[model samples]
Target: MIDWLDFVVLSLLALGVIFTVIRFVLGPKLSDRVVALDTFNMIIIGLIVFLALVFDSKLYLDIAIVYAVLAFLETIVFARYLEGKNNDNS
Candidate 1:
């Protein structure tokens, strides 16, 4: 049976997606868009974990872990590139 917590988590995920979309659409800077994308990725990881717990799926949890690692790597690479660009400009 689906619980209130599941519904709440799903709702939050939906809200996060909506906000991410807004950021992507209206963001004035590359960094702002990157931050929004990072948030979206993290939210997806959280949602996956939540669903895994709800459905008792170890496979989903494993996939979530993999996704988290990839997201972290992406963030690090973006940060490094942005920082290098700033350094070059200065």
Candidate 2:
């Protein structure tokens, strides 16, 4: 049974994701978009952990940990690529 608190948390998370998506879409710079993407990933991990808590399941927490690692690696790669691109342009 879902509770009011769960509904509120989920709603807020959903809204946060929506705003991040909007920022990603409308960002004036590639770095801005990358940051938004990274933030989105973090938000997803948060959602996964929240679900794990709400359902009392360890699997979701495990999944969130794995996802967080991957997201961190991906963001590092993106940052490196952006740095190289900027250096090349300058």
lDDT of each: 0.90, 0.96
Each candidate: RMSD: 1.8, 1.3
Model 2 ranges with Cα > 4 A deviation: none
The deviation in Å at residue 74 for candidate 2 is: 0.8
How displaced is residue 23 in candidate 2, in Å? 0.2
TM-score of 1: 0.84
Q: In candidate 2, what are the lDDT values of residues 9-84, reduced to their tens digit?
A: 9999999999999999999999999999999999999999989989899999889999999999999999999999
Local accuracy of candidate 1 as per-residue lDDT tens digits, 1-90: 658878887897899899898997799998998899899898889888887888897999889989999999999999899899999999
Best by lDDT: 2
What's model 1's lDDT at 59? 98
As a whole number from 0 to 100, the lDDT of residue 69 in candidate 2 is 95
What TM-scores do the predictions have?
A: 0.84, 0.92
